[model samples]
Target: MSKQRSDEPEIEPFTGPAGGWGSVRSLAEVLPRERVAPDALRQLARQNKPDGFMCVSCAWPKPADHHPAEFCEEGAKATAWELTTLRTTPEFFREHTLTELRGWKDYDLEQHGRLTHPLRYDAESDRYVACSWEEAFDAIGASLRPLDPKSVVFYSSGRASLEASYLYALMARMYGNQNLPDSSNMCHESTSVGLKAAIGVPVGTTQLRDFEECDCILFFGQNVGSNAPRMLHDLRSARKRGVEILTFNPLKERGLERFTDPQNPIEMATGGETQISTQYHQVKAGGDIAAMMGIAKFLIEWDDAALSVGDPPVLDHAFIAQHTKDFESFADAVREANWADIERESGLARTALEETARVYARSEAVLGIYGMGLTQHVKGVENVRMLVNLLLMRGNIGKPGAGPTPVRGHSNVQGQRTVGITEKTELAPVEKLKELYGFDPPTEKGLDTIEACRGVIDGSVRAFVGLGGNFLRAAPDTDAMEAAWPRLDLSVQIATKLNRNHLFPGKVTYLLPCLGRIEEDVQASGPQAVSVEDSTSCIHGSRGKAKPASPHLLSEPRIVAEIAKRIAPANPRVDWDGWIADYAGIRDAIEATYPEMFRDFNARLFTPGGFWKGNKAAERIWQTPSGRAEFLAPGELNATGFADADGRFRLMTLRSNDQFNTTIYGYHDRFRGVKGTRDVLFINQADMAKAGVEEGQIVALESDAGDGTTRRREGLIVTPYDIPRGCLGAYYPEANVLLPVEHHAEQSHVPAAKSVPVRIRP
Candidate 1:
């Protein structure tokens, strides 16, 4: 932390995007801010039993022990957030109305605290009043009954149990609407769609143990330290073992730099940090396909030269011949690829690109890990396939410590999507669910987060219900989402605490408080257990230690079950109560629904560290249409730049150190030296000169998203940094304003946060 400078900003010249550079520097003006602490901080601090409960914050792999340095800053924030002594009770809401609450800032709304009890907004009273759990459930049932099934949307957050998620999907499907939208629809749906299309499975290629035996790791667009910091440990371990972890990103992040693991007694005592990324290439955002193709080209050409001599070949020719198809065409495509195009589009010198290729060729085993940075682009799916193509070129898919690794966010997000929580159009899942639950699930495609927002505004949607996540705030085009949510007949959120989304109440809003993941769930049978799947695709048990924050707070499973039990076929055949009381019955149903994955769910859940599904360790038996890994090469490539007739820059939205997804924990990003605010930009120095802008200057952002929405942020900090030229970046969902819902990847409905053609104006 440092003091703020009132004047005389010494930002290096912006060489990246026009005008946006000046906005990057104003970040210096707001220096060193901290979260104002609540009266009491409820902390587990990674020291309290490692086997207790997984941190709801980030997906950092745990080794089932009480290692002192298990948790990172973000993990701590998540723990504090969940266990915070703060409460958002009915009395507090009684003083506030949806109209008055609409004026509150995102931070203030979350800062007021957790939801203590079930609350129903009273229109006549102009405030929220406390209601009993039964009454709340009844109100939900009443609202659910006669609306066209298509008019209702059932949504879930990633931080939910497997039992809860299954029940939620079952409940919605039983009520005749399979319009299930979830947090994954916003983040990793691209990974699921693209990877499943390419590889048979829809998750990452490498599991936890792969790090120890790997020689190379390809990192694309993932800020490991800030987002999933525990992964830093594996990288650090691999680095010590002489593995080359290549980082390809537009910006140089601090976490990617040498990390001093606080738990390493020697490092902490000696003030030492382990070097994580052996080679860091500043590739332009959305330019990964070109760079990846360059690797395949180098492998083919290098192997040819090697075989021509008396030397061994660079490629595993035997492996390629055994598994892949179209090698000759692939070779010709790479051979004819324009090096100039690759260099310029990638924003990397030819020498640097060749060096990365040389390293990748030398390593026999490699794991390419990516995050939203790759998926939030127009070429997101292509980028995924390109990475797989590079692996297939030399047969890097099935061997030890080699393959694609899509590092996912939201602890159980992968599982949520796996259990039919998708808003996809196919009604087969609905039909299957109907056959199981004795009711026909709606066949029409449901609204995703964006579509739901639009539906509310268009009057197509009568009510919007979110089982857990923050709907209004998580959406792009904040004004539209904020406005549209209130237009609904009934808007409801099942939350643990007060958040900005709760303030955006519709004509009728219900804020039903639920139990946190860390709280013990006592059921009719007795104390129960829940399950969550980590990013590695390993499902494990989670048993909470503390009692519920309040006795009135019900588990999310119970809440969803109650909602289901209330509004189902009048005299439904299935016993929803019997399943809710005993979570295993829910697990048994999950077993029947997904026997290949969840066989004997309860029995295996009690096993040490739980179970690993058919995952990374399962080898390369892809569940794709062809029952094998896939290779795809797009006919053309798109470059990074927001240029008009004249060259400008495209601003890419990013996450700051302070926030997690849409949750505003605080207004400080410790790694980037950003503090006291979430509104700032990062730009290259030379571009500032070209645009005639100075540091600490306020500027308006203009874009061509074609949604007729104007996204302008004044007083933006223009800091000089290592982002690629002709491009700019800022924090999201704040920067999501620049992204129109209409601007998404061609294949996956994911918004292109990686590339938004925009220019900053003075």
Candidate 2:
């Protein structure tokens, strides 16, 4: 390690295990500072409970038998962040001009806290002024009424409830608008697209109990420590039970290495930690497809050898012959694969691949778990399919303790998609929607996140309605998107807190404050409970017990319903007012729309751990065109073509331990040993040495997309760490500037955030 300067961020290895006193310390530090210490504590007590709200964090599933404290460190931050006492009232906005606020950091902007009233931008003064809800809604209606429906974008974030999302989707369709771009478009859209193409279902097949039963679990590119800390409990228990856990990522994430369960009193008392991963492989960034192919090749060759000797088959030939299609083509591709290329591209030796394959062959049951690391790539869709290919080789799908599980990021991202907040017209229940709402939903494909960005840039999109989320910050090419944001004729954001997205005022802009998920929402009908679908496809009810941040703040359903009533064409059959009055009515409509999946939705919602929306693939029922699981393979070994032959590094943007998505809770990343800054880069020690770059050396990175446009981020301090050679890591939203909006996954169109071809600016 090189010597650090005084101005450099505090950098050191975190020796402590994940989720011990570190989590406690973080919560302790954040709560009081946010001035929500008492109230947030009360809310945290009920988080993830049967009668309480779902955590406003990652979409990790809740166990049937819930722990007394089910929320994690990040979840606690989310709760405290929302339950903050700091208020961004009309007077607060009056003090800060839009131009001035636009120059502030994302963290500083949000520190002003929960939005108290509806606000409209005053271009004359270059500031936001307080406006009545009626004025805001009318302005939105006036702006939206004249625009072509196709010119409008209804962007929903994962934080919005299913009820709110349903209303938003319905409103968009009623107005003949098809664009329903959302947070999912940036993260797990590849998982949905790939899984649907391969298995007919778009969601993960494994239930929470599968963790207990699986003999082995393979994790890909997911950092469970920071992103989904609650998952540590399951992994710790699985480790204690002697299950083999294997991890593949550019960084050897501390969470996957070992975990000290905060919930385990004995472990907490003894300061004991459970060793998590049996083998942690630091694979090259964007090399998941290559690595997956190598594993499959080894397995196939082993099976071939066994078959030649007339030995018991290593592969599940019965499962393949009966339940799958196009196996021979996939096998042929694997057979034709060269071991040397696979080894070189994946940055793993052949021995390691063979050993991983041996583990898979011997295990009776295995769970294939992954996150955006596999999905946010040039070949993201192929990456997901390749993982599924490995699982299908051992008859993993449609079996207990087995299947591909995409660990989703947000609390209700999957639920938002389930409720029809999608750009894909086919995903919506059009016939059912028409019957319910008396309108023909738009059949044309809508703009996804990438297309939405393009639409805004080219001035095709006239309006942008955000249900929630920091759209510009979460998007690729952050600076470009932010610059292009003002091009929209109208911009409306329904959110809980003040963020930088709201500062980028459009020609006609409005900021509508909505109730946070952890705050009490008392509609006209009475107290209401919203539902969210977890990563496991379990639909559960979430009811807030804490006091509202402000009396003026409206519930998400009400805000969406009010906006719909104003802007959307009148539908006598649809009762938006009644649905807002009672969220149960919304649930009833959801059941009517997706009858097969949500039958008895309201009745089953409050059940201890909610009801499972069963996966068709898990039943060995493939809904593909051939009525069988399709074995798809990428055309080549260098799937992304982000080779290091030209000395360009594959950059994967990451979230700090203190951050959740674009929400910067603090400047500390406890796991990776970053502190007081988000602008540092993590490069391999050897790579840094070879490049003559010292630790804490300020450097610049520029995109090498060969598009003649320079996407660069400067003044980043290079920090040598345990990342793979030819790979570099930087925090997202900060590094998002380095990714071009056009560089995204094929077929899915999700931003290729995990693998961007870039070079260090000397």
Candidate 3:
């Protein structure tokens, strides 16, 4: 391996708990630097409160017993980032041409702060000029009016509130299309597909309270410290309660290993942090399915041995026989699984697999938690199915402190889907919507994110309307997506801040500035409070307290309503003006759409901690075609096995601790000890030696997408890390270019971001 370079930033390892003084210091440093106003601090403090706005970060559930400071460091950064004094007014846009803005980095683009007014592209001048909301909406309606409704794509970000998402989805349906593609199609789509097949419900069965009672928690493919720091608190508490925490990841994340609670002053002052993972298994990229299958095989063998000897059975036979089907086939598949194949595929020893199974089998309450790592692969759906199989072996569902939970990325991603933002228009919600709204919604399936991009490229999709997100930057194949975006006849972005997507102007492009989550949303009637469902299915109200950055800014609900009125002026099925005036009316329509789950929506929202939209799986009520939980047999352990070629490595894209989704807070990854740069590729020392690369050596990555087209990203510094052999990790959005647009999960169509095959060049 190459020796460390003296000129590079320090790469020392961190061994503290995820939170503590480090988080406090980072928050303090960011607030002042961002020029956060004094009133903004009050706004930040109200985050996650009964009378306040929900954090716009990750979807970790808020605690029922609210803490004075319920937000995490990343949440604080997001709040400060949004509430910054910096503003991108018309003058700012006038100063920066579209060409100049396109050349800026993602962080620099957002750091200029919130957009203050509506802008329309001036092609002659190559700049975005301020335009009135009415003119912008009129342009959108004009472009959309000519195209077939099937050619229009309505995309949403996970940051959208439930009320706004419902109205947006309704607008699309009323216009005679169901091309509702949200961020979930890029992140948790695999989870929804897998879980729905396994347990007849697309949502997680576990609640936040389950963490308190869980005997064992198995985390796969997730780094709670960086992505969802608030989860560290729950994990730490569970650890103290004698709960065994086992983590499976390609790299040994510092937050998962140990974490200091920044909320605990004593821990911060004494430098005392709590140990998190009871055991950390370094599974290779895309090896989670194999690892889970291996664990299942071990559990089956142990159960057989116990039953043959007349000892108490290891499996929950009663629960299995009563609540599930296809078990015998699933069990046989696990039994027939070859140990040698599991070892080679999972990169773990037989002994380690057996030990993990033993721990799982002995535990009465087990909780399985996963993130994008498990869901961003070619076999992502099967990977999650394997996890559910393991959980089913122990009757983990419908029990306190036990179930499978896929920690979502965005705050209201799940909520958006819950409130009818989906491509599948034949779902129950569509039928209910037809009955309630007096409009016959589309029954045909529509384009997801990947399909939408493909449609744009093939000239099938002509108009694109984005409701809050940097779609171009967040998608795979950045160069291809950028090229395809300009092919659209019309493109509109309803956002609070400037992003790379805005720089790529279509034939007719408009930027409609909307109020951020922290800004007060005043409608015709009065101020409104929107609701968002957390990871655990708890629906809570989010009422913004901070003043709007600009008087021109409108609430997301109002923007969607206004667009709907312009696009479908002749439609008399719904009253857009009435709903926009009172958010309660919007909730009433949502209740009519999903009556069972959203009953008493207004009253429950005003409750102390809002309400839980109970999960059918949690209640042991299966809603599948089989009328029971199904144990589907998984395919081969390593379905997407890399070719037996030399110099090949599986690359998984990851987020830096300084970033949230595509928005960058800074260049430093404090948790990983990488300072001042995001261009580093994390690789194991053995892999570095095998590739003939030394530590801190610059390298190029060429995609092995098997499509006969070469895609390469250069200038990535290879840094020796604790990753498994033959595996590498790089920051996302930067490394996204290496992923081909066609590379994605088969069933869900979500991008296979975790298991990209690449060759490193020195």
Candidate 4:
């Protein structure tokens, strides 16, 4: 390991429960720093409320009877970030060269604040010059119109609303190809792929209210308090009702252990924490498949024992027989699974797995909740399938408080996919588009984030249009991506704030500032409400109540419509002007396309808490090829796409308590006892001594992919943490450099950020 560093971050054990006075103090500290502090507070009060805007942070569902202060700590920060009075106008760009801006950190770049005008890169000045929206649109249209549809990529972030996403996808399809890739490709794409094969639906089965009814909630690889603090309210309520909470992760997350409601006065005043997890197991990184199989194995063996004794069956045989298929193969796979391998891979004692199984067996209703930690693996899809298989053993699907829940990141990522922002043309509204507009949609497959990046590197994709996200930062293999990004012919970013991705301007680049979700979106008709679908497939309206950060800022829907009208062939049938004039027209179009799920879209959208699209899996109506729930088996315990090499450890990237996705709010990771710095690695004490690394030692990490390319991240301070012995943790974006671009899941192609084989070195 490298020599010890003198400038070390303040590290201490966090003994307090999550979301107590600590959370309040965090919000209090940040709220005052925002230039629009008073406005942000006003907006926070309206967040997630009826007729108000949705939180721009995580996609945790809001309850029907929303809290007076519906926003959480992170949500409040996101609001403040959006509502900041700071501006990055043409003057700001002129003052700082692209090269100078490129050297700045991601957080510092965004802190310069929201973009106030449209800008075009000027090669002579090495700066972005202010331009009229029409001029920018015309330039973009000219560049895009002549290109082959397959050569262009449209990237959408989860921050986009359903209206904007709908138009964005429609524009791409109308323009002829579906080179549509978004944030979902990185986070929960595995859940979509896995659940569709197993349970027929691509979303979580439980509604927001199901947490109250569930007998047991099993959490796998999710840090609810940090990612989506609002979910803690439900978890705390479930705990109070005597529901069992079991957690399996590489690190014993503070959120999954205990949480005190910041909203509840009694708990906040008393500092009383409601215990979250009944059992917390520190499973190995990328060992979710093995851990899941171990639980399933125990249940299967117990069922066999019951059957042999002529006693009551442990498995839900009646439900399984009537509602599932391929159970025998899955059961046989679990039966043949080696206990030694399970014990080794999962890093859990057999007794612990058995005890978890016992609790699962007795529970009348069980809910499996997970996040990117389970999905960002080489076998990410299989990892999800294994969890689904465990749930299927007890017929958890199609029942109240019983199903697999993939907690989603971003506000509207699922909604983006729902609105046809995907490379999969089959998921697009092919027939509807044909009927509505006189054009043939491209039948050929388009590119996802991974394929798109490769296309850029190889010179196939010449153009990139991003709708609200720090794409380059969120992507794996950061260095390669940065080097290859400038190769694109045309690049456009429609966003609220300036990010690192904007610094790497293309040959012909345009930065189009757009209104934030928290800002008012006024059209020709009046103030418009856009809809977004939550993790549970519940679609709701979010009408911005806060003032626009800039007068020049255009709504996303309007920008997308303008681009569509300019780039796409003129079609009298496609009423782009009308859609921008009244967002209800867009909703009507969506309803017409997806009639079943979005019937009376406009009417139901304004209803309190909006409407649930409803999952067929919850009703025991499987749409799978087998016409029933599936029991697919994951054959291998090693899902990192590589074997255990000598002196190599499994590393997973983490988000700090003060961060959300790639948007860094501050350096402190209070949950992990990290302060004033993010460049720290969390390793177990045993692993530290084993590797000859001590606390405060600045080390470097090199990928063990052996792909001839060196992927390394240096200047990391080692800190002993409560992680598994062979597992290590570090913050993302910084660690993203260590991941190879090609290293992704077998089926989903989602980046394997949760498990990367690496060596700590000097």
Candidate 5:
């Protein structure tokens, strides 16, 4: 059925529990909102040796002395959801046919319970019958025996262990395919692409320690509390010490305005929320690049003019001369930029924009932090370049408490890219993988998410395997993922729980149940531990406390190793079982593979917080092709707000308060007053007025235009918001219905979620 108008899917709102970041029963609804007794949840937590699992939710840096309760609310939710006593055994599948399961919601799919055994969907039987691990692997291996390597696409999630990722990459390379469409392509592809072109590396330039000493912190589109609450403490401490903190975002998230640190006993007792945002600017959705370029624009011209007037100003002329190239063109772009246009288009007044520039100019050190909002646009790469340009103008990189901070969302997402997850560039380490394995890796550039989707539909891709993540739900345009999967010869999902992605089976579907990060991994050796790198490049150890939820549940590493062993090309010397038996062997292999990047891997992992990778920006050393960071000239600006047309307001899909990626928490977003359904769209009052739509009016939104097909979901209740004028916002996956697969960024293939051109149908 080409899904037509929806009279607003009912949204169920949920308020988080009183227990601060760790209290997650309320958020555990990401799986099933059905409330288990407090006693049952308490029991679940008691055994959850959560030490081994990286917080599945956010990338909070690991502590020197790990707390038994180091888990955050989202972490707890994911942990409980994974380690839940529930199970989706063979009988459960037998009772509820695939057809019955297909009718379920995303929450119900995961809530169907964890898979206890390796399952092969039996279409004739209309059930997922349990199969022997050997039988499952053999069947999978035989399926890949004849296809050209390019037909196999190895997709992975950020939550994957370093060992699993390395092995997965090795398998793909050995198989001679580079069709690696990872989570990075979907999220931080812009950051990686932009940062590499502008600076040297694709990772964040600053460390967490820099926050304490930063003179001024500028947050662009990042809501710290909801996304990264640990940053809340840092900003709070900085504010107390008289550091100026400026925030610019489309949504004036209440969490950004004031955050109560439930982590602090005294603050929790007093019920006091820290007041952040010394200055808040509600900039337009696509304004970040303009805003940043405006800042750089103002500082460059102001300082240049000031120097001519015999007055010293803020631009670091000496640093620019020594560490950068192409000054004249950059200066021209900044000087020639029209402030009226920037102010008008960005939805910020000139004075406010100029004042923000002044803050950057005046500060001895500044950190320009951004989230998905900046990098998920058509000009996302340029947007990042402008931020780096501002930093370079003042020599922010390589200085303490300064540089660009791309506030990533997940715990291991950064680690995924660092370990060479991209389909672009043949990274040195990945190259070494080819050299070590004695194979000629595919020289042709690999397909990213969008390319992979298109590849599958066109029959170029024969097999698709996801290490983790909801590929169907996580991807844009539900129809694209659904249509593509059925075309594949085989589709494998190595996941902890059942999701909709698994239901959309290929010709020969295999669902391999894996252990959650929070569960104990008892192999031939003993309990195992994994490591993850946060956005700041700090590597830390994660150990699981909870015992296996099901006796048959396989650890991620074990499952990956088994699959690699079976499905990998013949004549492989590496003993997959040797590594699976003990993660230390995997660590040793990683050390052998990436000695420069991962020195003393095994020894240092025993250290309290693992180790920190040296960030060049911290030392002001740009590793760009020029040996110094190159400041990119600003790109041309795109039109904004649809010429004040009476069309549909622009819709930006957002994650629900309780959701992570495609996993909907309780169908509600509290900060924005959305509850009981995700069918609500946040509309600017002015945009609503122009569109002739009221606050509660329901309307149709078509997510795509270019493609022959369109995703139309109607009956969306419009909620007026304090967002940028002419902008609309709604929850994703549910709203993924409205995001066209083709509406992606230029350099990154990332969906231009923040700025898709759409007209509201009255």
Candidate 6:
């Protein structure tokens, strides 16, 4: 057989509403080829149901009322991909060497199929061999027992269910390790830190129901159509209800511009679509903070002018006075922000900012929704805080239809954090763990994702255990990470499919196959259901009905329990077997851990649509040091101008419509009008002219990290796109090699993947 080759990417302009017959056709093509069973439609129907499996693509909240089909095209692709009949057994691994596998693209590696059995690396043979669960567990235990607990870093993916995350956290703490680095560190850590500082909470305050009541909604740096397709339904409905939707993004996302719900048969058949965004502002890359501050300044000026005439004040004076603090300082900062600086930084006119402010001020209830665009920046925390400052000016929080909402990427990422997966070991969860499991949790701050990578590079982290993620490919500075990964004494990955991470073996590597979310998980007691928290903080049960991909597969909860049993056999406090046998017991423990928040956890699962976890910000109850919502002011507006002296473009890494996180479903990005390949860069037409480059010119991209360390990706076809001048867009993982590991958000420590300074080489 010959080596696989990607076809040349074909680029064209797409002009249609997102999610219509096109999505339906795409789903049809993938489903049949994946050998989806006849009952696959039934299984899809049950998705997002109270007692059914949750879509593994995104964390958008499920509606209170269930539709016949609650899943999106991306969700369908994820499900079909998971349920594919292909299997990667021992023979498959024997046929392909690690070196050969390394040559394949990320999509091909996972597309090869589901892992069937446990495998261990045979360094002498340079291949993986079949290993029993007992042997793998024993080897892991022996390797971990000798190493200092601090030398091991336990990392988790957001895809892990609440039960698995809870058990993984417990197992790590019981083993006396606090280095818990999760996927959230790379994505939403900025939102957590920013929101915690401003409103005393890390989660979004807006509920799904709030969309119904919102008069105006602002989408900052988020592409709702591609990232979270289901969100378009809410936007379409809101638009129909005369709700004004304002969009601020560098690219003109079709989902935010116009959307045709695939679920609406009449609209799909008639080729009718609803316009989503009333006003679309093309902000520059890393300019969200400036745009937000500009809006705040306009609102403050309007309020002052209104108050000077003794007329009705534009600002919510009563709400601000009663429910907030530090208003004077925050207002001063907004007032002092210069318009010229804001315009230069945001790449938007002053009149546009004033118009947005006018719409916001006139609306009784407004909602601000953002994604990684706002969070994956050098000053990501400040960007989020500035957004909150804008909303606070009108008292948006703790009210119906108004608040700040950070849309999470992964399906259960928010749930994983809610279930105690954090580097910081808080007193309440630590005390609860001691009471329930009799283990003293670590008190010291642990390593985050970046710190974990640094630890691996410095040889401080010897053993690595991953619970469901492709850490090697997902992390930044691919060259550095690849170099650091082999230094570990042992590395283990608990995953459902074969990813690039598995090919990068340590001294002793183990690949443990776990059941996918679409498969039945039969525990010692019986079939079990795991719960996940949505972006809106709704806790619901997800029970898979599909058959297991392989009989050798073990549930994630069971794997964690067995691993803990081997590593901490002498710890008599916790009954690992008991917890794995039944997941309800785990929920009971979660209730004990967060008594006030998760009271009656098991019973609440039976509710028609899941129970809300309840946010204090939603209730107008502040939990900050001042016992009120605090207005955190941002610093001076210092935007990384569109281009540098050397004509370097500000490159923002993005995901294609056919991809989720590190998982690539196909080579086509229907919405973006790219097909057949991923090796392409979306550049503005003017930038092409300025750089003396033509359309479809293959160019090399070199990072301007300023560390004298050269990092570059060669032979990338330049496609002129509808983007801001001097700004370029490229797919992640493929472009991750250009990002420096040390370049990250100031306070959140998240790698600034969204805003990397790079220069093109012809």
Q: Assess each prediction's global lDDT (C-alpha) against the native.
A: 0.72, 0.88, 0.88, 0.89, 0.73, 0.87
Predicted model with the maximum lDDT: 4
Residue pairs clashing, model 2: none
CA lDDT, candidate 4, residue 496: 86
Q: By descending lDDT, how would the candidates be arranged? A: 4, 2, 3, 6, 5, 1
- Predicted candidate 4 versus true structure: per-residue lDDT over 308-371, tens digit per residue: 9999999999999999999999899999999999998999999999999999999999999999
TM-score of each: 0.91, 0.98, 0.98, 0.99, 0.93, 0.98
| Candidates, ranked, TM-score | 4, 2, 3, 6, 5, 1
lDDT of 3: 0.88
| Top-TM-score candidate index | 4
Q: lDDT tens digits, residues 39-137, model 6?
A: 788889888876788888899998769778899898999898898887789998778899888999888888878999999999887889999999999
Point out where model 6 deviates above 4 Å.
Answer: 1-7, 639-643
Worst 10 residues of 3 by lDDT: 1-10
Lowest-lDDT window of 10 residues in candidate 2? 1-10
Model 3: per-residue Cα lDDT over 364-480, one tens digit each: 999999998888888889988889998998899998989998999999999999988999865537667767767788888988989997887788889899999888888888887
lDDT of 2 by residue, 99-150 (tens): 8887798899888788888899999988888889999988899999989999
Candidate 4 ranges beyond 4 A from true positions: 6-8
Pick the winner on lDDT between candidates 1 and 5: 5
TM-score of 2: 0.98
Better of 2 and 6 by lDDT: 2
